[model samples]
Target: MFKKAFMSLALLLISALSWGQGNPVHFTVAQKQVSPSEVDVVFTGTINNGWHVYSTALPDGGPISASLNVEKAVGAKAEGPLRHSGKEINIDDPIFGMRVRYFEHHVQFVQRFKITGKTYSINGYLEYGTCNDEMCMPPQSVDFNYKGNGPKDAPAATDETAAATADDASPADSAAATPAGEAQDSVAAAAQAQPADTATASIGDQLWTPVIDKMKAYQPDTEGKSLWYIFLMGLLGGIIALFTPCVWPIIPMTVSFFLHRSGEKGKGVRDAIIYGISIIIIYMTLALVITALFGPQTLNEMSTNAPFNIFFFLLLVVFALSFFGMFELALPSSWGNKVDSKASATTGLLSIFLMAFTLSLVSFSCTAPVVGLLLVQAATSNNWVAPAIGMFGFALALALPFTLFAMFPSWMKKAPKSGSWMNTVKVVLGFVELAFSLKFFSVADLAYGWGLLDRETFLALWIAIFTLMGLYLLGILHFRSDGDNPKAQPVACIMLGLCSLAFAVYMVPGLWGAPCKAVSAFAPPMYTQDFNLNKTEEVKAKYTSYEEGMAAAKAQHKPVMLDFTGFGCVNCRKMEAAVWTDPEVQKRLNDDYVLISLYVDDKTPLAKPIEVKDSKGNTRKLRTVGDKWSWLEQTKFGYLAQPYYVTLDNNGMPLSGSFVYKEDIPGFLEFLDNGLKEYKKR
Candidate 1:
């Protein structure tokens, strides 16, 4: 049960840490001599499709803004702050809840420096932030270098703005026109074309060794998991829908309609089969139409878009109120009448299809909410076929009973009769929808930077909702729909009430900022909590620096647990709250392994940037503590996403498999155990 709970939470928070899996932006740097003693260092970034980088000129409390930092300069001094090519997008960002400026597709940053010597050189890096519609990447960096001889003749000073604004023109053209720029470009090309060993020698001793080959050998297979999970969730919803008052009564009527259509049992069974097929076709076709209308990318955008989330929140609240018996929600009576008349008039497969359509229309109130919630989830999956796949499962489960009853007519006697108990089911579902509606609203609130729904407030509301649901289930409370007298509470009802009460109790502590790991994915982040007292003793890492951690690991004769994480990573916090806090996991991490957590989103700048090459042989610069660790993770394990965990020996060789953004405690323990076992073997 605990495992299942954890898995569910993991699935809920999957989107938080699943993005930035690979490099979404590529960068190159070059130099152009604009004057005899001055040069323009141009940095160009080519962002991948559907991703963007924030601009350098943005206010605080927003996404990370791009900036240029010069780590080392010899015989030169920076003329001014960095400038960009000016093609930027300015918008009121939903995710950050602020007005932001960013660049998509391609952008360039240029810095001008004045040379004071016959030979001059400069070294620096560009720092930026990136995100797609679904999620954001950690802060990223790219390195730049230039070395050249100053022109012999001293030329008159040029207008700084005129030279800097060369962004309007081509800096490359100027670079090719000048001897110095041409020389520098040739040198850069030569450097890039140099042998790996020579380049390595130039960079000095490597701080961390690459383990890409070993890491690749143990990459996790995550493909198809989302679609399977979506299908199963849809199936669960379908099963729940079957118990609703809207759908349960239709089963027998549908079967009877088929039986009355023909005198022979075989003919009736064949017609019922066709009816079931029609239901599947109708639902799947709906999914296809939705996909065709919006496509996957737009659907993904809608999932996180603020206005759409707000709209969905209101829609769900209305659905929940309807389920609470405030008012009935029905399709137009005329539409159902039209379909019913069509079914009555026709005499073939078309008639059977119309009958299925009529049943769908009649059940709209109950099924629409469930279907809407399912499709919303599928949209967030970022998969084109997810909606269709989800609908297929829902349709299969909804259609299964009619086909089954037709095959075994006697089994119909065993089916439970619908009653006031169905109303109870609907009200309970109302409570659930009401609770979930807050999740959508919270997304919009966070995106718009609205402080209306903080962690404590969200928890308090959930606690109240569930407590009332428990009371309703236990017959201690009644809704307007419950009528005057309470029905006899069945064993399942009692069990569910107790469970609901238990869950409410569990969340009570969350009001004061408890982890309440069960709802970590649903609740607003802990950072949003106004008051928190549930702090645990954090499992401190022995060292934060890779070299120091490795030295300590070697001295202690223990494996190093390299934790590539980020402050902005939601699933990292989930794992820390739900998995690392486990007694067994804590003990294993503290005692059996030396932990080293590298936060890729840390903003503390380094004393000076350092040049390095990733495992993919791309040269870049590390300008901050975050940059250093982030580069190490990419260079060694070839993973940019977090919370990434991999165990390594003292020599920096991978000991076992890698782990990323999962809330499975036992699986994490197994990963630790495997690494430990492998270390012991050595």
Candidate 2:
């Protein structure tokens, strides 16, 4: 009997251990009533030993950091992001080629709440993913609750044991002063940690909401029309066509074709007119189909969706490689061949239209990249009609040249031949496509909190790419079928060499932690660098929470530097890595101001209620910090674009004429200095 009991006990222990290893994430919420007006709520998470949780400061392209969502409650305002205190682990990520800081041990996230009613209860769920070293566990949401007394008696203020112990004073003094100090500290910390009050607001909160609302209000319902986006798409399409072999050679051929198609001398005008209309219809139909498939909501979702962005990056890279002559991308010949056969059999007007359609089909290899680029741009634009409109414009531009030249075939003599220059244009566009692919990768990296595409790494990649491109342009490199042009053309050669030299010069400072402001939005945060001057003080400085920063700003009567930046904002990264690194700029930022960076792309949700007026002017509670800041940015700034810098006084009034975008480092510093001076004068 004893032996059997021992074996059973051992088996039970083994089962228990296995169960613990597979345990789902568990969350607990502890509440301490500070006063009638405030309460401190602490969120603690317990994950299985092998599992890890991401920090709020997860770099771009990493993982979905933990977020807190508080259900709506009456008369209570939750104020701030979850503040984590625990063990930290650093790991080098391959994508960005940098170290990413994260939390491994059990983590505690603290948030404060201010009560406006007589009584209330805090209710919310902690949302996060558990990842072991090799793979990630699916994200889980665990519900938690904390009951609280109403404002009637003004709940007794309680000081943290640490703070109380540190006082080392008599019980009487500690009781009276410690409670007040703790309350004050809690409030101050809450204010500072609140994402809405921070200098840098998240992109979703700052730019997307307002722009989306504006687009919605203006269009109300974008069912069919291509709208403003179509124009942009068309412009890009036309520019892209200027480089393709099919389009370049056909420019002159089409003009002659139109002239021949037009029977009478003056009748050439009619043929040109019909051809242009056909092109518009074809591209517009394509755009319409895309809009119908992916509406505004999907577009918005895709912008921040990590997996989708990664796929897009890979797709573009493949397209770019194909363009660079790794392989040919061709449409099924059946479609174009059928159109070509019809073109030969049909007569007059029908034949002309069929021939135009056939030409478009045959040139799919050349136009596919442009189409893909436009579709991606339109999908992310938040403008439903942008794709359709852009395609229409592109098609119109392409057709217009053919029509106009046909009307006056004699002018064909002025058209440039499809020669070595055409191939050069293709190569240039291939490089462009390659560069843009990185942007998508950066987005995915930032969204996933992966540090694979940080600022320096991005710049290094660009430097290498541009260097290679310049070398190729200068005839130092050759590809398959590359003609033996031992002698380089003076103008082309000089321009290529000079551009290469300039690009190399531009990238040199980036290696030593210089801000390459020109391309900030495309790069990662400057803070990711191991040797960045901007990050040095940031690391050593007593990193105050957003709530603490706000309280200090309020007490000091200092203006707030509202920086609406993002992990994936190329311009924002560029501004920080390049412009912010300037000596004069660095000195001013460090000395004269309180800097707050609000990453619009940050996935971490706030622990409190984010109330803001929507485009309709109705007050709405924002569930995330990104939403609140996005509303603020749109309502306050006329523009919806980012790298938005706003200087606001203690009361949050925009310091008169204080706003900036990328590449305005000098202007931005001057603006901040001037605001400081004016505040002092006042």
Candidate 3:
């Protein structure tokens, strides 16, 4: 049941832009005088590069097909069904998962009519759908008006002239006529071509002032905060490493070696500081090497790449099993020995650097997995410097104790002794690693369209892993490396075990589709659950189109919320699950504001493609709905990231500033409150 729900939700989310103000198909209407009482109405369209106009003979449930509608005809009787001419290509669309027929670059439609009066007029619209590889535009229509006067008492054409006329007729006249079944459908579609609603036209006429400058004031510190987060994660990993058996024992040994090597306390402290700095430099150098090898763009791709994510998932699982004492994973013993000997033979800064390298090699068994996890996370950040910054923080945390112990040697005696406790810590981390390994697998599973690790499955695994961890911590579970006395658990370990048990219990309700906001960032989306108690339909935007939504907002006298988001954006989901789930935020979003969620990754095309310039002044074509909104976010607010929120008045002027991905409810409440206040002021 959960698997079916996950597939349905994934399909809906995955199925759900284009810029610009350029019409993908430019239409021209011309009248070809065929005889004294007959004429051909030719509609020729020049489609833009990369854009395709669907054929009139398209299968049902496919894209909008080309059709000619005669809404009004004066003294003219329709003779036959409209005929179409174009190089129609039939191809299977991988994205839409359907076979479709469409025309590229050019197409033409012609309808012949029998004229019964000297003066006649015809007015109609040509409707079709256009799309490119990136995005699809909404159904588009082009209005065409034509008037013609037949010669007064004109003579009938001679056979030569008639033959010439037939030869010179538009290709659409000789093109394959619409099949009998589709011909009636085309006529019915033509009958439905109505003029634009006056009310919608008035809304379109309302001029919207650009709010880029106003929004610039509220551009949050995106990059700085992201790097800071990566650094903190690295630092936390390093601190965890300090409790491991391999690194914890060596800390006292390394500090004592530095202190004894120099009798003067100042010299020992200085040497230790240098050694810490050396460690930082060595790790940073490794980070740089990783950055150089993969590069930022490659790292970003690897983050979502199925194969890459799967490989990391397996690697992390192996690391977890090693932590559980199945086997030891370590660097070559010879490498550590060589580095230690080099440090002994060298002197000054080089000797200290070699000593740091030796320590790094020796502690690889415990440190490598942590560093690998850090690197994997940093890779997903899509920033070239993230790995280096994370490494700097990790190394700093790893080295801080060494420097401090050398400066105050007496403090070293107070440190916890290396014992079975260290092994216990390692085993607890193994549980953590096991839990986190699923996260990587989930990413791959999602990308590959594998429903194996749906929300319920993921939560079940996490609950089981953490429950086992809690049992191990409470001495209820035992491993080969565990201390002989199972009941001799420390108070701190017991507390941690209880917390883990509590957390596991907390996730139990999530299996039933409860909004477990705490773990939303790590778990699959709520839609993946077969039975969800929390209904988010009420919070979803009532209107998706910008113009339609803004028009409604104006009528309702409410502020507009331009929610710049994406289907695949993890942070956007986090914001929705965490912050938007708050009562106040939900109230304001539902009652006070008109939400227009613009998905930057939506593949649905625009009604008509437009040509515009990006920030870099390059000519860009808006082909899809995502492209259109993404362009708007970049051009109007100078932002290209997801989960961007901005409040605006009906006329589209900024009411407040823009907001990015932040989970702080109070801060977001302030943002919305300010927008309401500003709206009321004006």
Best by lDDT: 1
TM-score of 2: 0.59
Tens-place lDDT digits, model 3, residues 407-519:
98899889998888888878888888888888889877754445688888999999999999998899889998774665588999999999999999999999887766678
Model 1, which residues run further than 4 Å from truth?
1-22, 26-65, 69-80, 83-125, 131-210, 213-226, 292-308, 382-384, 447-449, 484-486, 538-540, 565-588, 598-631, 661-682
Ranking by TM-score: 1, 3, 2
Tens-place lDDT per residue, model 2, 1-682, is 3223322322211100111213345667777777768887777877554356765545434444555556544445566555678886776654334565556558887767677556665566655545443234333445666665666764443322232234322332222211123323533464565555445433343223223333233222333443565576567677667658867786676656666765575666677677677777777775665455443434544654566678678767866776788876676788889998988898777876887787677777777776676666665554555666667777876777777676667777877766776666666677878888898898777545567777778888888888878887777776663566544644876597569758867986887677676765666656556566444332011222333454557766666676765433434544564457666766656666666555443333567756656456867555544444444555555433346666556555455443544445655667778767766766
Q: Candidates' TM-scores? A: 0.74, 0.59, 0.67
RMSD of 2: 15.5
Give each model's whole-structure lDDT: 0.73, 0.59, 0.71
Residue 300 alpha-carbon offset, candidate 3, angstroms: 2.0
Worst 10 residues of 1 by lDDT: 173-182
Worst 10 contiguous positions by lDDT, candidate 3: 9-18
Ranking by lDDT: 1, 3, 2
How do the residues 1-682 of candidate 1 rate in per-residue lDDT, one tens digit apiece? 3223222322332221234367789988889989887899888889865577887656543555676655566666677666888578777643334677788789988878887666676776677778654345677767777787876653433333343334322332222122222223433453354333321211224536677887878766544888898899888888888889889998998888788879778988999999989989998887776566553335545667677778667767877898899987777788889999988999998999999999888888888777777877776676777778888999989999999999888999999998888889889988998998898898788665568998899999999999999988888888788788777889888899999999999999888866677787678766667787756565756455566566667778999999876544444655675568666788999999988777676655667768776546776666566777777776666777667788988777888879876556667888999999999998
Candidate 3, RMSD to the unseen true structure: 11.6
